[model samples]
Target: MSTRAITGDQWVVLRVPISGEGVTAEVAAFAARRQLRYDLGDDGTLRITDPESARVIVTVRWKTLPPQVPRTLGFQLPSAAAVDVLIDPGPGLAAGRIAAALHDALSGRALAYTDGELEGIRAAMPLLERYSAARPAFDNWALIFRDHYLEHSTGFVLAMERAGIPAEWIFALDKGDRTWNRERVHATFQARGYRSDVLDNTAVNLPHAHGDELARVGADIDAFLDAAHTAGRRVLVVDDGGLLARGYGAIGAPRTADAALELTVSGIKRIAAAGPLAIPVLNLARSQVKSRLGYREIADSCMRRLQALLPDRKLIGRQVLLLGYGTLGSRLAAQLRGLGCRVVVVDSDLPALIDAAESGFTTYRTAGQALAATSPFIVVGTTGERALSDADLDLLPDGLVLAPFATRDFCALTENAVHRGGASDIPGVGMRFALDRGRRVTLLGNGRSMNLFEADSIPNEGYDAYRAGTFIAAASLCADPGRVPAGLHTAPADDAIAEAGLWSAYYDLYAAQGKGAVRPPTVPAPRLADLPAPVPF
Candidate 1:
């Protein structure tokens, strides 16, 4: 029997021992089979682009050296027949599948791992294993609503089941999901005993859609609740908060969740805006584990994606204006500074600004002040709220590139009446708009989280510990829904997460283990104000 291995969101790099011509033909066949397009650059770089989105899904580079030259390209030059296959990083098994096809076509030695090495190279989930051993019996059925089709998400659901949480039904919003994540989710659920629904028109501003779209999502939730109730099992909502915000507050609705775990800060805000909640809601967004540990990974992804999207622009010694000094923003500022970029931060919150200043970043009270003083080449928005107003767009430097880590950061520009109509699409990149006096500013993504815009932002292993924390919190909340009161609970969730011994598991699993294994320093993260802002319009 082949060994099953655990993995994360990553790109697969395969080196094939075939001639350049042979590999190129195989790649062409691969693209033609999928109805994809390809571009062969002058520098022996072959790119496979998606037909619909115009995004590069795969890249192939050839390595060749003369017979007389003794220089090796990192390995023994076996007659110069090696071409590196770079499968784009995504959320599903598609990359692996593509790699397998190419490997087989070229009759090359094993370079694809997931499909090739079905056994070995798998990392064990220590925290999940420990929690599963405890046998936290969750009697009720669960309405698992999260980003669907992600490999890690599938792993998360499987982990939940392993930890004794029964998922009655699964729901995923039909937006911003990677193609493979959707395919993997559908295939996984179909094979398993659970029914999953990809709710259309529920990705953003749900229940507020007024017509068919709203009705469809509402009916789906109603059906899930009814089924769980008929089975004499209370429904526990494991959400990113979209479904909970949409259905949990329906007046005279069929039923409500017994307990809920809200994941993202956006979800927490949505749940609050939708009126009073009557069930115990564990605030995983504000938990110490997520805020302190998870945000760092998220920030890292943001920076990585920014660099990937703008491959030609040099990051070192660049002038950057960073909007928002919250958890994600602060971390991004520090990282940008570390990369030798002169990073200036802006925030409405006084304490956050003070913290940024003390952290050695140039800080400002508002974005306008920062814009007036510095002409930045890149403007990064980490504020989950509106970072730039429509009028403020005029003040931006000519040829400025806006990289939004949050969805609503550049909404003012993207949604502006004039700019929206006049904007031109820069395929593979984002939208480019002409501002006043011939100044041009480009949005690096579709005004969504740039890191997640057609890209897997964080690695699966990078966030495994936090996912474990969420699971621990969910298990605790679902085990006894009434143990805590019916409001957003953060500290208690953090307590439960801390007790799960995730740090130890993480250290053992990821960090180097030796005689002198140094434990990370315990520094309490600065508390951000819990004041709720209105959901981005």
Candidate 2:
């Protein structure tokens, strides 16, 4: 927690003479701003870098209170850096605090990682934040998931849910999500088995405002309003308030509640009073209710969808770095390990490292340590910070930095990370892969699947196909999930539709003939094997 680091994992910068500008000083200064702790007390050697990303471009033996046997060590400080890396600090710092510190360390500062270095680290922040976030609220309502995970901490409510009551569970939503989240519904249901026919009541009993119905309901609306006024009606729904005239004729109920919890208040209290009723109404807008509910089905569906989209990355003789070990990272690790990847998880949060460790993830507190040991197969950032630094960029290995949360800062950090002491100029291309009918079958029998595998060969219940399709869909959204890669690209909507259509065709193509479905396209025969192997280059 207190930045107490273990060593042997040092970014050894290959030394050049220090005559002009003490590069070490610059490095030290940059690090100091980030509040990195280090002391340059050695045999004219300074070692600097986080445990995960430092390269030791040149390794020199530094003498700390004690001297070592090797008068010198051979390694170079890494100049190659990714924009994002995991940080490890004592229990004192929150993720937000650390991010602010790093931003100040580099922005408008001197002795910072080279311009190239800064860009690379910034590139991966948003992605890391995503990974660093607590478990996401489940939204995929169509699948099964663990119920307790999506619960909103209420015993009475949870009890009703587990009892299979036809209870309509709802939650207030001022916390910014607009759509009804399926995960919340599913989780609650899973925890408490309910014979619930889930419905979206936010738009209850009214024509959609955008459709022609709103206009149609308009002129008739005023007539209802006039009738209510003439009847001397006053809206009322209370147990005791002495006798008073109550409004009986109203055209429609209020469309939306002013606040989330208020939505369930009035109607729900009445329903609850009807002890042991079959159709129970749980008021979600009762102020203290959670903003969103969690549900098992939603969780399962999301998990499945995510698992489907995730590429089964393998270590199989490759080096790799896993930036953040929060929920996303945990899932990613499990999947990758299944694919035979050697994973090492890094995080600034001690609890995170502990979680990963307990879960059997190779946990690390710093990027510098991971870098000192080996170049990774891939560098995946999950924390929501610009973790990489100029010093880090100057020493990266030749590999890909997969950012699950790519943003402008993330792109810039990675784009400008110092490679070989300077900014990288090798711009990458954004490419897409689809199961284009091949003369012969393959991931790219003309096009690679978004799962990064060929169609049939792509494992995991056609997840690759779905991913491929989503790439096209993402492209259509002009939403570059990552940097505007320089090469080929898999657009979002186009690819998503293709994958969807393919799956539909695979199952229903034959049904078009007024019967059961027929098999769509079969994997081509092996006879065309000599036809150029889908242009891997």
Candidate 3:
């Protein structure tokens, strides 16, 4: 040996706190190939044991950065997790990318994974530490469930187990109910013309859900809230109404700041008051949270909201067709009915159509069946399914007042219809969801690939790529190489690249440590040969 240095070798332990076990193989595989000795640290830390010498240097790989830019989690050592990676102002950057890579390498299969951004309430502080005799974390980290996808759950579990993080601390409880926070089902957008169910309720209503009924609903909500308050578990509330829908309305804990998730907006003060709380209230409409100008959502929002200012002159008055009355459409239908417009909700589902009818909103099965004035009012498609037709357009003439709020083509059907039906290609406007006025806006653009039918209403498929990346990173870290707390990680791609870049800079700093101490890039991160068992210290 030509006097190998001890600077770049150690048993890297990754305490992956996820629900699945994979990506572990990748770390090991990578390490094996690079001939790096990796030891799995069971006590929530990846212990890289073998170096050329016994002298140790800690590298801080705090979570939160790097979809490209690594932002620091402000990890301090009142009892710091081991680290030497920070170059004075290290950690955080490029971390997000690392996280994404890890998640995919590990639990990519399951986990309706999306890239999360771990935003800190405090100023982007330096990684200061309160040392407690060289140990791991002093405060326990938390993990919560956001959905019931078995893949996510399994992947999370597997990742955590493989990382060798203790099981007791990582909770993985799933909300047994599916409709807990479903938006489309509970009806968030449309609020005018009635649905069949509302019609049915109105048709045979002995009385409205009130008085004693309201009391009953209130009690149930209280019970749910009480349970959450007592637990203080940092839970991931995972129902699909874009993330908030307790129809007939009874959300537990109006004071929603508990460790126990399903945390509602009600308890903001209390929740925020409880320590350094990181509230990642899922922006159901993130598909629209951006832009230089105030956010612009589907034109319909302007149409619907017009009621508050003009009250009677609401957008509902415009001729409109409410398609797919699940959660997204139902509200749109109601909103249309409010604006004094002739509204017809078309859906194959008899019950939904019936609900639409009940709500004072007319219901039709298909666009074909409900053909009124060809180019009637605004044709807003809500179902994440198909598109519109040319025949339907022929009647409406103002060239189909349209808005596509999806990643895929809502106008696909109509696009095809135009092509198939041999009519002049009259394309609909595309809505781009962006952030504006501090809230979000869906900006309607000209093209279709990046911005048509892309939801301003909710963000289901919108964040899949980023989420996928985080999952990949987390999983990779969980490998016998490295893993960090999978909690509250806000990984923006910008942050990920930043971290790597920072790492490079830090390496340079380490080399120039003054006094003529010179060195080349610290040996590259060793590759894993195979997913290995946690090597003992």
Candidate 4:
């Protein structure tokens, strides 16, 4: 059925095939929830009018009679009056693809929706491609992402190559176990029809590397940057923190060379004074941490999985001492509380402590007091700083578990303890550090980021947001490096919105395929009395 050109305004019609009875209701519900006005026809036609300035009309038409009919979604462009998009709702269509198509049809315009409405559309549709008529230029640019055996970084590299961007990868291999291999990573990239040049630096992986080894790695990065500069290629470095930040400093001040860095918090602080244009992908924008597909999801999922590893230590109905009430800490607290664990949050920041208290969690100004009071079954550090002082360790109860949500720095205080014959290997629990001779405290992942060390890989939904941030960073740098200042920057508003939509769509698709659950945990709200009273200053 053809949609008649309604008089007075142009329309962008989206015609989708209806295979069953519920399709129309689903579409109507989606439109209503989005606050989009629609006109329904008895002949199985629905017209959706965009309230924005574009005046685009989306039409959904049934190709077959009544139920079990195939449907088509078509979009009519207002800018290009003659252009129209007709997409067949093929068998096994994914919600993400549909959303991508719609977003693409709207010319990448942001759509305002109520909370959960985006997820609703994502669940209803699942997968669609955002069709771009013109691929952006990246001829003079090259991308370098830190490969950590996750699909997101590799996926981003593949995507950049697909967009005609020259891309390479860098892998900080675990020298002890060779956790990441250059040959394996290259082979994986080769399978996708791309040649990979990975800077496999073992020194970067060694958190405790010192002396000549660290200096050698620094020189290696300096040379790499110099080569890219001499070649006149704009280098976009992802995962520009930790060891990589040290390398950036070794290269001296940022020259007039074409080099841009996308960094985490630590990286930004290290290189900010050097005057290199940096996009702070990890924390600058609240969206990066607060979004549905954020680190919290990964942290929560990983923490819950710890139950199987340490079956004897029951996570449910146990007290958890959380050090540092940052994004990761707060999210993990809520998830643990959902599983019936009493969560006590400790943070030096008064505001963070207050926030935790307000969120119905017991808050403490010092780790020692929290540990002594709670006698927690598990202690998690999320502050990215040394969470446990030597004094605090002395206060920890025997048989307690210590897990770091951040990198190893958060647990640095335990290093000396481990070296002084304080840690002993537990049968199934790995190393258990003894603080006061007899008090055995199990250290998870040797005080590394438990989520990264324990989880096989970050969930694809969370990684999708990471990939989006990387893409935006690279694209922004490529578009005009000079336009981006030397200071830190957040993902552009439009890119953030587009990425959020993509993230929801991908999450819904993953759920439809039984990959994993992307929905946030549903927990009973905590009562104020259930938590300890806030410590007075």
Candidate 5:
């Protein structure tokens, strides 16, 4: 084989000899089989060039190959004949080695391979290896963002661009409204010379088409993914929860999973179970403590809205039923108590109920007992799951208020009742849903997230922490995947500390710009005192 280096380029030109009889015909046949383009010289020399820089060559004499050259490429060639397969390491030596190792292992390598060799191969596939080697991780990365308004999404793209990574945005407009400033997002992408696409929530339910209306939208998503794959770009899906996951799963799981990296706020549990590296950037317990403040924001917002809508009904001295004593529930409970409301906590999870009990609050294993006893003036559901069933709705007192702090599903029963003329709002109270037969119940934000719907958005200070933590997590993942195990991993401790510093800097920056700044409250570290004492089931 003859080799020569090209100046200022990582690529090199190499010639591998095919010495057997009918060498030209054999090489031509192999190239044709591999769908490789080639040309035959007048001297009968067969030459093949890769459209991209990568090329692979294989021959029977593996031992004769250069020591610096990788052996994994040789394993891919047909063993039946002596053939020279030339491969160009377009992504540089490190990526080439990693890709070759993965391909080699996936293509049925010998079982005799030692653990040390496997570890060495895995270590080569770190997220930043390609970037560090002067090769792009992919031609471009597709960023599937749940909220375009969130600074995190925009900031992430900006950071990646600064690092010399080409990225595009795919925004999920869940409500299909122009309120999200579509024009502004488009203008930003255009000014930055990046491509972007918008998809609505309907795409989540695939194969069940909504006639011609949503067909084009579905086609858009498909075309976007196809273009990314064709261009050899990787996809990084940053979603709030199940929307993108379900959409991707609906389209085709294997192919989508192969090309995308999913970072979710709420769906990491499900995604991690499927054997992919699902980074939890937004989980309440794992990533950042900012969500605790978000919960407080939602609670405070809901209380203020309630007061404005019904000035006669005060939250102080009211009996409140709180469901799901998780991160949101616990924080909201504390806030409600501080506001002079007596909070009764209920959760199906025994440990959660016990924790609430241990926290010096009244606890109930079921909503029935709490409802019957309290006849609560206000009911707040913080569990991500459906907290109120039809039966639970029937048990509610005539004049009561319902608020879902976690997700919109908590208000499903109220929504259904309202549609059926079983619920209606009091005349003077805004967002107060009253039931038929003179029964009145106020449903806050119609069961949607109070923080988003009532509070307008997450507090800027909390959002800063969330975004900073996410930035550090993404960068850390890229720099070293070996440090992160293949499962749902907590945000790095360093990221949490960095998040605080980042938030402080952000506050100072805001102040310097003459904008009033609100520094996030220092969240006390979680204490084990809230843990439930062991009680044999």
Candidate 6:
């Protein structure tokens, strides 16, 4: 749908269908990127003001449609909603394309502009494209977990569709995302002729309701697998540990995928706890491409989210304690030092502690020791396991902030906080638990990866190589499942991704000077709580 500006003497209005995702954050981020001043009100209304004069330049208004009438231009709207962008007709505002740019941003549709104008618009907001449009043949169907807001992930799914393999279904389980519209991805997929619907399992929280949500998602997957089996098409599972851990085993029905690809280290741990698998499982979690390249971006995002959460706090010259000196933790420790902070690193592994000590950081064997030695204002947790024990909770400094890169790192406080004073929510910042002796600690995120807590931390360009590598691995595995035995395999997928010349593609796209490495537009990092939440469906 092409969105045109309805012009008047004072304001120009741009109307577009809303997908019930986080539209307010998208608009606020748009304003922040352009260095434009924007304000969000309590009633879900947004106003963009002039930076110099502080006068209102634009007003974003939202309109809701009744359930009886939900179709627009023959497309089903996720929520009965639409948004109107009211812009000022002032010169130098690029008034003609502001509405169109926002329209394309909110709704992933083609803009009604000339070729030259289209090029400019693309430069303003570049979408992810397949590294190579080579249509490889694949036999099995796919069920993948993806954050639809990320364009690179969306591109990965589209690339699979372009290949012979069909996406039977896609999953979006992140309930805390606030920047991009996952529903837009859902609508875009439907519009592009893909028969996949985003299975939203976001309503399920972790720890307490983990099994409940997993069972719900597993049932859906079981049904999909059954349909695929009846159609004589074996399904390939691309899991992020959410399914393979417990839910995949709970399926009482005789439904299983032909092959599976595990994505994260946490996922690998979950799979290990779940015991050996029946089908061939490829491990992309241990791939060199991801370890050598992707972890850096992940660490960068972690720090970015931390900084966004503490915008007013100064990091320079302050002592900071970091748990786990693994791939992500090591990188985050370095980043913390680079920010001029006194970094204290803790690791259960002796070699890791020695490595941190050799790297000129204050190393400790546990969080208790680190807390006892240094009075850090911020304590970062990267260990996937429990970083702080129940006894260690007694050592927490007053008003110390805890930033968890993994979910279970600070589970001691989040999952079970035992103190005479109790815990309370800090609004945009996470929960603040009162400790004994009048000391308290604040959790930066909801006991999950801080980078993924209501924020699009990693840039599409930053993670392009890893996603492409995953695609290469998936295509190669599906083409010949016999290559990997009926067990979890890592070397085969790593070799395949390496043999596919992914590093060359990545270098050419990002590192090599004068190559087609185009830096995508910078995504604005903001506190998501301040942005408008989507209207519930």
Q: In terms of TM-score, which candidate is strongest?
A: 1
Full-model lDDT for every candidate: 0.66, 0.31, 0.33, 0.50, 0.48, 0.65
Runs in model 4 with CA error above 4 Å? 1-134, 167-209, 247-263, 269-292, 409-414, 417-422, 426-429, 491-537
Q: Where does the lowest 10-residue lDDT sum fall in candidate 3?
A: 123-132
Model 3: runs farther than 4 Å from truth?
1-316, 373-375, 390-393, 406-409, 413-537
- Let me know the TM-score candidate 4 reaches against the reference structure: 0.61
Off by over 4 Å in 1: 1-126, 133-136, 165-168, 172-180, 198-203, 206-210, 247-254, 512-537
Which candidate do you rate higher for TM-score, 3 or 6? 6
lDDT of 1 by residue, 413-476 (tens): 8767788899998876789988889888999988878787666567555666777788788777
lDDT of 5 at 102: 27
Which segments of model 5 are wrong by more than 4 Å?
1-139, 148-218, 247-254, 257-265, 269-285, 289-312, 408-437, 480-486, 491-537
lDDT by residue (tens digit), candidate 2, 206-241: 225323533433323334334433543211111110
Compute each candidate's TM-score over C-alphas: 0.71, 0.26, 0.28, 0.61, 0.56, 0.70
lDDT tens readout by residue for model 6, 52-95: 98765556666553443322111222333455544443334454
Each prediction's RMSD over C-alphas, in Å, is 12.9, 27.6, 23.1, 20.0, 22.7, 13.5
Clashes of 5: 16
Q: Please write out the lDDT profile of model 5 over residues 129-241, one tens digit for every residue.
A: 11122224323555554544332344444445645455453434332322223444344544556655554333332225544645565465566668777876555555543
Which 10 successive residues of model 2 have the least lDDT summed? 238-247
Candidates sorted by lDDT, best first: 1, 6, 4, 5, 3, 2
After the best TM-score superposition of candidate 1, give how far the Cα of residue 227 lies from its true spot, in angstroms. Answer: 0.8
Of candidates 6 and 2, the better by TM-score: 6
The whole-model C-alpha lDDT of candidate 1 against the native structure comes to: 0.66
Better of 3 and 5 by TM-score: 5
As for candidate 1, its clashing pairs are 149-181
lDDT string for model 3 (261-360, tens) is 2221212222333333223332222211111011222334434323322333235346766667765566556556665778877888999888888888
Between candidates 3 and 6, name the one with more favorable lDDT: 6
Q: Sorted by TM-score, highest first, which candidate order results?
A: 1, 6, 4, 5, 3, 2
Question: On TM-score, who's better, 5 or 6?
Answer: 6
